[model samples]
Target: MKHLSILVPDDRSGPNTVACIAGTYHAFTEANKYYGTLGRKPVFKMELVGLSKRSELVNGMLMIQPQASISTIRKTDLIIIPALGGEFLEKNFVDEKVSAWLRGQYKKGAEIACMCTGAYMLAATDLLNGKSCSVHWKSAESFHQLFPEVQLKIEKLITDEEGIYTNGGGYSFLNLLIYLIGKYYDRQTAVYCSKVLQVEIDRQTQSDFAIFSGQKKHGDDMIRKAQEYMEHNYDRKISVDELSKELAFGRRTFDRRFIKATGNTPAEYLQRLKIESAKKALESTPKTVNEIMYEVGYSDAKAFREVFRKITGISPLAYKNKYNREAAELLFMNDAN
Candidate 1:
C-alpha cells in the first residue's frame, strides 16, 4: 500500500475554519492507525502558504506562522482547501501567488478538494462553472448569487465528478473520507477508520436525517422529557412502565405521545438507538463483533449481524474489510508517489 499525501489549508474564521481542518485531521489520523499496523504510514505535512498572520475579530483569535511557504503544497497529491473565518465566502479572490501555485498544481493533475466556502477559491479559478457541486445550505443562497455559473447541490453531503470535489459543509468531511476510503480501499476500511475516530457509523448516504433536518422543533414537552431519559439510560434495561412513572404520565399516555412525537415507539426507539451506538462501537474499537453486539444490547452475535445488515445494507465484516483495503491502497499510492 502507498501513503496518501493530503495538504490542509489554514486561514483565520465564524467562517468554520477549525471544523474543516478538524475533519481532515480526523480522517488522516484514523487512516494512519490501521495503515501503521501493516507497516505503511501516510505522510502528513501541513503548510501555511499566504497571509503570515490571520486573525478574526469575532472569533477573538489570531494565527501567526513564522515560516509560511507554499513549497510543501506544490508537491502534494491531494490539496484540501478549508474555509477561513467568517469572511471566507464574502472575501475577494486569494492573493496571486497562492492562486497561481494552486492552479499550477491542479494543472498538473493533483486532486483538489474544498469544503464549504473553500469552494469559493475553486470557483475563482473558473474551473467549476456549470459543474455540480455542494455548498453548505446556509450559504447556498448567497453562493448562488455570487457564482451563478456553478450548479449547487445542497441536499447531498459531497459532490465528486471529474478531478475536483466539493463538500456541502464542514461536517460532510466524514462522508468525504468514507467515500475516499471506499474508492481507494473498500468499505470496511472506512468503517474501521470511522470506528477508530469514535464517529457513529452512518449508513445513510443522504445528509438530511430527520433528527437533523431543518427547523429544530421542540416537540411536546412530555415527549422531550421521555426522550431525554431514554438517551441517558440506553445502557440500562428500562421499561415503558419505568418511563411512565418517572415522567408523571400514565403508561398509556407515555406510549401514545412518545410514539407520536418521535415517530417510533419506546421499545423500537431504544432498539434503533442501541443499534446506532453498537455501530459506532464496531468501528472505533478493536473489540470483536460479538463483544460489541453484546455491549449494545444484543445477546446473540448472529442476530446482531443480521440486524446490522438490515439497517446498514452491509455486514459488519464487509464494512471493516472495505475500509482496511482503502487505507492500504492510499498508503501504497502515497508511498509510490
Candidate 2:
C-alpha cells in the first residue's frame, strides 16, 4: 500500500484549511472504496500527519485535529501540504520542525504536494529551488520576492515538477485532487469522484481568474507617473516613446525603470491594461467582441484575439460566455431546449 500523509500545518488558513484536509482525506478514502468494489486491496494508507495534535487558526475561529504526529510516521509514499493561514512569508512560515521533516521525507523518496499558498511551507524546506510552481495569483508577487529561484507559473491552476505538485488559489486544489486521483488510481475513479464532489474535472488553467493590477510597489516616482498615465489612457493609443519623452527620460531608461519597477515592459503593461478593461466590458456589458475590442483600443480583430488568448488562455467570446452570467444562462437554456 502507498502510505499517504497529509500535513495539517500548525497554522491554519482559516476554515478553508480544514476544507482542504477534509477534501483530500475524503477523495482518497473514496478511491479505496472504489478499489474495494473490484475486490482489490486499498491503495493508500492515509493519515493526517502534523507536528502536533491540534492547531487553532484564523484568530481561534477554526481548529484542526491531526490523526498522527509527524514523528510517528516512519515512512510515507506521499506528503500533502494544505493551504496555510496567516501571512505566508512571515516568521511563522519558517516552522523549522516541519520544514526539516519535509526535507527528510522527500530525501526518503516521498512525493510532496502543496495546495494553494501552502507552497510557502513547501518552499521553506528549500526543495523547490529551481523548480516550477503554480500559486494563487494574488500571492504570486510575494512568492517571487521570497523565492526568485522557484519559477512561478501564475497562469496554471496546477504545476508538477519532479515529485512535487502544487495548485492555485482557493478551491482550485480540487482540480489537482482530481488529477492525482486519475494518475494514482484510475480515470474512471477520478470521474466518479468529480461527480460526487461536484468539482470541474480537467481544469488546467487559472489565467481567467487572475487580475492584473500593476506592480507599482518599487520606489520610483517617474515610473509611478508612467504607470498612472497608462492606467488613465488605456482606452486610447499612447506611445511608450512619447510617454518617455514627456517624462524627460530616454526610451531605454524608461523601459528599464518600467520593467524594474513593474516587472512588465511598457508595451506589455499597456496590453494587460487594455485586456483587463476589455475583460470587464465582456463581463458586465452587452457588447459584441468587436465593439469591446475597438473600445479597448484594438482596431484589428485578429490582433485583439491573438493578444487576448496570449494573456488569458481563452478567446474573447469564451471569456464572455463563461463569466457573463446572464449570457451563460441564456446560452445554456437555449442549448437545453
Candidate 3:
C-alpha cells in the first residue's frame, strides 16, 4: 500500500478545489471500511497539505501543514494537486519555491496527479511537454494559448504513461479518485464509495465526445443564452414557447438549437436544473419535499419524485434517509476497519 500526499495550492482557487481532494480521502477511508471484508487491509494512506494562508503548520486529523519545505516533500510516494489558479501564471511570479520543488519531485520518479486547472502547474513544470493532458473545458483554450508545446486532449480525463494524470474538472476529479481507489482495492470498493457519495460513476474517464453531442459545440452563442434563461427562471414553470420568444427564435428552431447545444430538450434540461435545485434544498433547507417541489416549479408530487428518482436513482425521501444512514455507517465502519 502506498501512502499518498495531496498538495493543495494556497491561492484563491484552493478553497473550491480542496473539496475534491477531501472527497477522495473520505472515499478511500469509507471504501476500506465497507469493502475490506476480504481480510486484506486497505492499501493506501492519505495526507493533505495546504499551501495557502500562511507558512504555518495547522495540525488536524486530515489536514497537514502548509509550511513544508519542498525538500521535505521528497519522501511522498504520490503527489496529488487539487487545483492551481491563474495566479500561478500571473505576470508576477508566485509560489516559485514550491513550484521548483514540485519539479524536483517529478524528476525523482514521483507520480503526479492533477485535477482541473491544476494541470496548469504541471504545464509550468515543462515535464508535460510531450505528454497529453486534459484541463477544464472552460480553461482549455487559455491553457493552449499559453503553453503550445503540451498536447491537450479534449477528454473528460487523461492519465498518461509518464505518470502524469490530469482531469477535466471537479466531477472528473471525483471520477478519477474512484478510478484510483478501484485500481488499488477492487470494483466493489469503488462502487460502494460511489454509492456512499451519491454519485453514479461507471466510466473510467471522461470521453472526448462528451464535450460535444448532437453535432453541437455546446458553446454556441444561442445555446448559452437559452441556458442562461433557464438558470434565471429555475423557479418558474418555463414553457418552450416562452423560451423561444424570449430568445427571439421560433419554437422549432429553439428546440433544435437547445438540443444541439446541450444534447437535451429544453424541458429535460430545465427539469434537471430543477431537480438539482431541489437537491440543494433537501440538503440545506428545512422545507418539506412538497414545498420544495412547488418551489422548484414541480406542481405534482408524484411527477417530481419520479423525475428526481430518474436523475439520481433514488427517491427524495430515500435519498435523504440513505445519506444519513450511509454517513453514520461509514463512521462506524471506519472505526471498525
Best-fitting candidate, scored by lDDT: 2
Q: Pick the candidate with the highest TM-score.
A: 2
Q: What's the lDDT for all of these models?
A: 0.63, 0.87, 0.68
Candidate 1 minimal-lDDT segment of 10 residues: 207-216
Residue-level lDDT tens digits of model 3 in 116-183: 88788777778778888888766755666556677776544656558788777756687777766777
How big is the positional error of residue 337 in model 2, measured in Å on the Cα after superposition? 4.6
Model 1, C-alpha of 65: deviation from truth (Å):
3.8
Which runs of model 1 end up more than 4 angstroms from their true locations?
Answer: 1-12, 41-68, 87-91, 184-186, 200-337
lDDT of 2 by residue, 9-30 (tens): 7764666687788899998999
Which run of 10 residues does model 3 get worst, by summed lDDT?
207-216
Positional deviation of residue 156's Cα in model 2 after best superposition, in angstroms: 0.3
- The C-alpha TM-scores of every prediction are 0.53, 0.92, 0.54
lDDT score of model 1?
0.63
Q: Which stretches of candidate 2 lie over 4 Å from their true place?
A: 89-92, 244-257
Which window of 10 residues has the lowest lDDT sum in candidate 2?
85-94
